[model samples]
Target: MSLHHTASQEATRRTALRLLAGLGLYGITMPSIGQAFASDAPGWPEAAFKAKTQDEVLAALYKGKLEMSKDVTIETPEIAENGAVVPVSVSTKLPGVTSISILVPENPYALAASYKLADASMAMVGCRLKMAKTTKVIAVVEAGGKLYAASSDVKVTLGGCGG
Candidate 1:
Protein backbone atom coordinates (compact mmCIF):
# COMPACT_ATOMS: atom_id res chain seq x y z
CA MET A 1 0.00 0.00 0.00
CA SER A 2 1.04 3.62 -0.45
CA LEU A 3 2.77 5.40 2.46
CA HIS A 4 -0.30 7.56 3.28
CA HIS A 5 -2.63 4.53 3.20
CA THR A 6 -0.24 2.53 5.40
CA ALA A 7 -0.10 5.35 7.94
CA SER A 8 -3.90 5.71 7.98
CA GLN A 9 -4.40 1.98 8.52
CA GLU A 10 -1.87 1.92 11.37
CA ALA A 11 -3.68 4.76 13.13
CA THR A 12 -7.06 3.05 12.77
CA ARG A 13 -5.68 -0.22 14.13
CA ARG A 14 -4.18 1.56 17.12
CA THR A 15 -7.49 3.20 17.98
CA ALA A 16 -9.36 -0.09 17.65
CA LEU A 17 -6.84 -1.85 19.93
CA ARG A 18 -7.19 0.82 22.58
CA LEU A 19 -10.97 0.56 22.58
CA LEU A 20 -10.89 -3.21 22.93
CA ALA A 21 -8.34 -2.99 25.71
CA GLY A 22 -10.53 -0.54 27.62
CA LEU A 23 -13.55 -2.81 27.31
CA GLY A 24 -11.51 -5.78 28.49
CA LEU A 25 -10.33 -3.88 31.53
CA TYR A 26 -13.91 -2.84 32.34
CA GLY A 27 -15.11 -6.44 32.11
CA ILE A 28 -12.42 -7.57 34.50
CA THR A 29 -13.26 -4.83 36.98
CA MET A 30 -17.04 -5.31 36.96
CA PRO A 31 -17.09 -8.19 39.43
CA SER A 32 -14.47 -6.75 41.74
CA ILE A 33 -16.45 -3.56 42.14
CA GLY A 34 -19.14 -5.49 43.97
CA GLN A 35 -16.52 -7.08 46.19
CA ALA A 36 -16.00 -3.79 47.98
CA PHE A 37 -19.23 -4.54 49.84
CA ALA A 38 -18.38 -8.19 50.48
CA SER A 39 -17.12 -7.58 54.00
CA ASP A 40 -18.15 -5.05 56.61
CA ALA A 41 -15.45 -2.87 58.11
CA PRO A 42 -13.93 -3.79 61.45
CA GLY A 43 -15.73 -2.58 64.64
CA TRP A 44 -19.13 -2.91 62.96
CA PRO A 45 -21.68 -5.29 64.41
CA GLU A 46 -22.52 -8.46 62.52
CA ALA A 47 -26.26 -7.96 62.73
CA ALA A 48 -28.99 -7.46 60.16
CA PHE A 49 -31.08 -4.38 60.85
CA LYS A 50 -31.31 -5.29 64.50
CA ALA A 51 -31.14 -1.66 65.47
CA LYS A 52 -34.73 -0.75 66.35
CA THR A 53 -33.67 2.69 67.49
CA GLN A 54 -31.40 5.53 66.38
CA ASP A 55 -29.11 5.14 69.37
CA GLU A 56 -28.69 1.48 68.52
CA VAL A 57 -27.59 2.38 65.05
CA LEU A 58 -25.14 4.94 66.41
CA ALA A 59 -23.71 2.49 68.89
CA ALA A 60 -23.26 -0.13 66.21
CA LEU A 61 -21.50 2.28 63.90
CA TYR A 62 -19.32 3.59 66.69
CA LYS A 63 -18.79 0.18 68.30
CA GLY A 64 -18.80 1.16 71.97
CA LYS A 65 -16.82 4.33 72.03
CA LEU A 66 -17.68 7.62 73.70
CA GLU A 67 -14.79 9.16 71.84
CA MET A 68 -17.25 10.52 69.28
CA SER A 69 -18.50 14.07 69.83
CA LYS A 70 -21.55 16.00 68.65
CA ASP A 71 -19.76 17.96 65.96
CA VAL A 72 -20.76 15.54 63.23
CA THR A 73 -23.82 16.45 61.20
CA ILE A 74 -26.08 14.13 59.20
CA GLU A 75 -27.94 15.36 56.15
CA THR A 76 -30.70 13.62 54.19
CA PRO A 77 -34.06 14.36 52.67
CA GLU A 78 -37.01 14.43 55.05
CA ILE A 79 -38.65 11.92 52.72
CA ALA A 80 -37.66 9.44 50.04
CA GLU A 81 -39.47 6.87 47.91
CA ASN A 82 -36.90 4.32 46.83
CA GLY A 83 -35.00 3.16 49.91
CA ALA A 84 -32.35 1.57 47.78
CA VAL A 85 -30.73 4.81 46.69
CA VAL A 86 -30.68 7.87 48.88
CA PRO A 87 -28.34 10.82 49.05
CA VAL A 88 -26.56 11.45 52.35
CA SER A 89 -23.99 13.95 53.47
CA VAL A 90 -21.98 14.34 56.68
CA SER A 91 -20.07 17.31 57.97
CA THR A 92 -18.43 18.37 61.17
CA LYS A 93 -18.48 21.90 62.48
CA LEU A 94 -15.99 21.11 65.20
CA PRO A 95 -12.77 20.32 63.36
CA GLY A 96 -12.58 17.12 61.33
CA VAL A 97 -13.52 13.51 61.58
CA THR A 98 -10.96 10.80 61.12
CA SER A 99 -13.75 8.65 59.68
CA ILE A 100 -17.45 8.74 58.71
CA SER A 101 -20.13 6.08 58.45
CA ILE A 102 -23.79 5.70 57.40
CA LEU A 103 -26.36 3.23 58.68
CA VAL A 104 -29.92 2.22 57.80
CA PRO A 105 -31.91 0.20 60.32
CA GLU A 106 -34.43 -1.47 58.01
CA ASN A 107 -32.00 -3.02 55.57
CA PRO A 108 -30.55 -6.49 55.87
CA TYR A 109 -27.29 -4.86 56.77
CA ALA A 110 -26.88 -2.65 59.80
CA LEU A 111 -23.53 -1.23 58.83
CA ALA A 112 -24.62 0.76 55.82
CA ALA A 113 -21.97 3.43 56.21
CA SER A 114 -18.17 3.60 56.73
CA TYR A 115 -15.39 6.04 55.81
CA LYS A 116 -11.76 6.53 56.77
CA LEU A 117 -10.38 9.97 57.30
CA ALA A 118 -7.72 10.80 54.76
CA ASP A 119 -7.16 14.31 56.09
CA ALA A 120 -7.74 15.27 59.68
CA SER A 121 -8.77 18.68 58.48
CA MET A 122 -11.46 17.50 56.08
CA ALA A 123 -14.72 18.70 57.58
CA MET A 124 -17.23 17.12 55.25
CA VAL A 125 -18.06 14.41 52.71
CA GLY A 126 -21.18 13.21 50.95
CA CYS A 127 -22.32 9.89 49.54
CA ARG A 128 -25.26 8.24 47.83
CA LEU A 129 -26.82 5.98 50.45
CA LYS A 130 -29.20 2.99 50.20
CA MET A 131 -32.02 1.88 52.43
CA ALA A 132 -34.44 -1.03 52.65
CA LYS A 133 -37.48 0.81 53.97
CA THR A 134 -38.66 3.88 55.79
CA THR A 135 -35.89 4.09 58.35
CA LYS A 136 -33.61 6.45 60.18
CA VAL A 137 -30.26 7.27 58.52
CA ILE A 138 -27.33 7.93 60.79
CA ALA A 139 -23.90 9.42 60.19
CA VAL A 140 -21.07 8.82 62.60
CA VAL A 141 -17.88 10.81 62.63
CA GLU A 142 -14.72 9.46 64.20
CA ALA A 143 -12.33 12.17 65.22
CA GLY A 144 -9.80 12.74 67.97
CA GLY A 145 -10.04 9.06 68.78
CA LYS A 146 -13.77 9.48 69.41
CA LEU A 147 -17.06 8.80 67.65
CA TYR A 148 -19.66 11.57 67.25
CA ALA A 149 -22.98 10.85 65.53
CA ALA A 150 -26.05 12.44 63.92
CA SER A 151 -29.15 10.95 62.29
CA SER A 152 -32.19 11.69 60.10
CA ASP A 153 -35.24 9.73 58.96
CA VAL A 154 -36.02 8.89 55.34
CA LYS A 155 -39.42 7.51 54.39
CA VAL A 156 -39.04 5.10 51.51
CA THR A 157 -42.15 4.40 49.47
CA LEU A 158 -41.48 2.57 46.18
CA GLY A 159 -38.28 1.00 47.50
CA GLY A 160 -35.19 1.32 45.36
CA CYS A 161 -34.40 -2.43 45.27
CA GLY A 162 -37.98 -3.12 44.22
CA GLY A 163 -39.35 -3.73 47.67
Candidate 2:
Protein backbone atom coordinates (compact mmCIF):
# COMPACT_ATOMS: atom_id res chain seq x y z
CA MET A 1 0.00 0.00 0.00
CA SER A 2 1.06 3.62 -0.64
CA LEU A 3 2.33 5.68 2.36
CA HIS A 4 -0.71 8.00 2.41
CA HIS A 5 -3.16 5.09 2.04
CA THR A 6 -1.57 3.20 4.97
CA ALA A 7 -1.67 6.35 7.12
CA SER A 8 -5.39 6.81 6.41
CA GLN A 9 -6.15 3.15 7.27
CA GLU A 10 -4.18 3.46 10.53
CA ALA A 11 -6.22 6.52 11.53
CA THR A 12 -9.47 4.67 10.84
CA ARG A 13 -8.34 1.71 12.96
CA ARG A 14 -7.52 4.05 15.85
CA THR A 15 -10.98 5.62 15.62
CA ALA A 16 -12.69 2.21 15.64
CA LEU A 17 -10.68 1.08 18.69
CA ARG A 18 -11.60 4.26 20.56
CA LEU A 19 -15.29 3.78 19.81
CA LEU A 20 -15.25 0.21 21.10
CA ALA A 21 -13.39 1.24 24.25
CA GLY A 22 -15.96 3.98 24.92
CA LEU A 23 -18.81 1.55 24.49
CA GLY A 24 -17.19 -0.94 26.84
CA LEU A 25 -16.79 1.72 29.53
CA TYR A 26 -20.40 2.78 29.15
CA GLY A 27 -21.59 -0.79 29.53
CA ILE A 28 -19.53 -1.21 32.67
CA THR A 29 -20.92 1.98 34.21
CA MET A 30 -24.54 1.65 33.12
CA PRO A 31 -25.59 -0.46 36.13
CA SER A 32 -24.14 2.01 38.62
CA ILE A 33 -25.92 4.86 36.86
CA GLY A 34 -29.21 3.01 37.18
CA GLN A 35 -28.56 2.42 40.88
CA ALA A 36 -28.00 6.15 41.40
CA PHE A 37 -31.32 6.89 39.73
CA ALA A 38 -33.08 4.26 41.78
CA SER A 39 -31.72 5.83 44.94
CA ASP A 40 -33.40 9.07 43.83
CA ALA A 41 -36.54 7.44 42.41
CA PRO A 42 -39.32 10.03 42.09
CA GLY A 43 -42.06 9.00 44.45
CA TRP A 44 -40.18 10.53 47.34
CA PRO A 45 -42.02 9.99 50.63
CA GLU A 46 -44.40 12.84 49.95
CA ALA A 47 -46.89 12.06 52.73
CA ALA A 48 -44.14 11.35 55.22
CA PHE A 49 -42.33 14.52 54.31
CA LYS A 50 -45.55 16.47 54.78
CA ALA A 51 -46.62 14.81 58.00
CA LYS A 52 -46.94 17.31 60.88
CA THR A 53 -46.63 14.81 63.71
CA GLN A 54 -43.34 13.28 64.83
CA ASP A 55 -44.78 9.83 65.38
CA GLU A 56 -46.30 9.74 61.93
CA VAL A 57 -43.09 10.69 60.21
CA LEU A 58 -41.05 8.18 62.20
CA ALA A 59 -43.45 5.39 61.43
CA ALA A 60 -43.22 6.11 57.75
CA LEU A 61 -39.43 5.95 57.63
CA TYR A 62 -38.39 3.54 60.39
CA LYS A 63 -41.61 1.61 60.98
CA GLY A 64 -41.15 2.23 64.71
CA LYS A 65 -37.71 0.54 64.61
CA LEU A 66 -35.70 2.89 66.80
CA GLU A 67 -33.59 2.73 69.94
CA MET A 68 -31.51 5.34 71.77
CA SER A 69 -27.79 4.83 71.26
CA LYS A 70 -24.81 6.38 72.98
CA ASP A 71 -22.79 5.96 69.79
CA VAL A 72 -24.77 8.70 68.05
CA THR A 73 -23.94 12.31 68.95
CA ILE A 74 -26.00 15.40 68.18
CA GLU A 75 -24.40 18.82 68.34
CA THR A 76 -26.51 21.97 68.43
CA PRO A 77 -26.49 25.31 70.11
CA GLU A 78 -27.75 25.20 73.67
CA ILE A 79 -29.77 28.32 72.91
CA ALA A 80 -30.41 29.48 69.36
CA GLU A 81 -30.79 33.28 69.25
CA ASN A 82 -32.20 32.99 65.70
CA GLY A 83 -34.73 30.28 65.15
CA ALA A 84 -34.58 30.63 61.37
CA VAL A 85 -31.01 29.36 61.16
CA VAL A 86 -30.01 26.91 63.84
CA PRO A 87 -27.00 24.81 62.97
CA VAL A 88 -26.84 21.12 63.84
CA SER A 89 -24.45 18.23 63.33
CA VAL A 90 -24.85 14.49 63.77
CA SER A 91 -22.35 11.65 63.67
CA THR A 92 -22.19 8.04 64.74
CA LYS A 93 -19.43 5.62 65.61
CA LEU A 94 -21.64 2.67 64.76
CA PRO A 95 -20.87 0.32 61.87
CA GLY A 96 -22.77 -0.30 58.65
CA VAL A 97 -24.45 3.09 58.60
CA THR A 98 -26.85 3.52 55.71
CA SER A 99 -28.71 6.74 56.46
CA ILE A 100 -28.80 9.78 58.76
CA SER A 101 -31.95 11.76 59.49
CA ILE A 102 -32.67 14.89 61.51
CA LEU A 103 -35.91 15.83 63.19
CA VAL A 104 -37.13 18.86 65.04
CA PRO A 105 -40.18 17.75 67.00
CA GLU A 106 -41.62 21.21 67.58
CA ASN A 107 -41.41 22.38 63.98
CA PRO A 108 -44.40 22.26 61.69
CA TYR A 109 -42.84 19.12 60.21
CA ALA A 110 -40.84 16.87 62.43
CA LEU A 111 -38.63 15.43 59.71
CA ALA A 112 -36.06 18.07 58.88
CA ALA A 113 -33.61 16.20 56.65
CA SER A 114 -32.73 12.69 55.54
CA TYR A 115 -29.48 11.57 53.92
CA LYS A 116 -28.79 8.33 52.09
CA LEU A 117 -25.20 7.33 52.58
CA ALA A 118 -22.96 4.92 50.73
CA ASP A 119 -21.00 2.29 52.57
CA ALA A 120 -17.79 4.19 51.86
CA SER A 121 -18.97 7.53 53.24
CA MET A 122 -18.29 8.90 56.70
CA ALA A 123 -21.15 8.45 59.18
CA MET A 124 -21.50 12.15 59.80
CA VAL A 125 -23.80 14.86 58.45
CA GLY A 126 -24.52 18.51 59.24
CA CYS A 127 -27.31 20.91 58.37
CA ARG A 128 -29.25 23.90 59.70
CA LEU A 129 -32.79 23.42 60.99
CA LYS A 130 -35.53 25.94 61.67
CA MET A 131 -37.20 25.85 65.03
CA ALA A 132 -40.61 27.32 65.90
CA LYS A 133 -39.74 27.27 69.59
CA THR A 134 -37.74 25.44 72.18
CA THR A 135 -37.78 21.72 71.47
CA LYS A 136 -35.84 18.52 71.13
CA VAL A 137 -33.64 18.10 68.05
CA ILE A 138 -33.25 14.44 67.27
CA ALA A 139 -30.83 12.52 65.05
CA VAL A 140 -31.72 9.08 63.81
CA VAL A 141 -29.13 6.82 62.25
CA GLU A 142 -29.75 3.60 60.40
CA ALA A 143 -27.02 1.03 60.82
CA GLY A 144 -26.92 -2.72 60.36
CA GLY A 145 -30.68 -2.94 59.80
CA LYS A 146 -31.47 -1.08 63.02
CA LEU A 147 -32.28 2.54 63.91
CA TYR A 148 -30.45 4.45 66.63
CA ALA A 149 -31.22 7.92 67.96
CA ALA A 150 -29.79 10.83 69.93
CA SER A 151 -31.47 14.08 70.96
CA SER A 152 -30.60 17.52 72.22
CA ASP A 153 -32.74 20.42 73.37
CA VAL A 154 -32.41 23.71 71.53
CA LYS A 155 -34.09 26.85 72.75
CA VAL A 156 -35.01 29.11 69.86
CA THR A 157 -35.50 32.73 70.84
CA LEU A 158 -36.57 34.02 67.41
CA GLY A 159 -39.43 32.64 65.40
CA GLY A 160 -38.82 30.01 62.77
CA CYS A 161 -41.24 27.64 61.02
CA GLY A 162 -43.63 30.60 61.29
CA GLY A 163 -43.35 30.69 65.04
List model 1 lDDT by residue over 1-163, tens digit each. 0111245445754555565778766454345655666544323344423566555655544445544445667788888755556888989876545666676767766667566565635768888877778888767676655566777888877845664
Q: Please write out the lDDT profile of model 2 over residues 1-163, one tens digit for every residue.
A: 0111245445754555566778776455335743653432222455567888878877766654679999999999999978878999999999988888898989888888888687699999988878999999989888887889999999877545555
RMSD in angstroms between candidate 2 and the native structure over all alpha carbons: 16.0
**In model 2, how large is the Cα lDDT of residue 71?**
97
The lDDT, on a scale of 0 to 1, for candidate 2 is 0.77
Which 10 successive residues of model 1 have the least lDDT summed?
A: 1-10
TM-score of each: 0.57, 0.70
Best-fitting candidate, scored by TM-score: 2
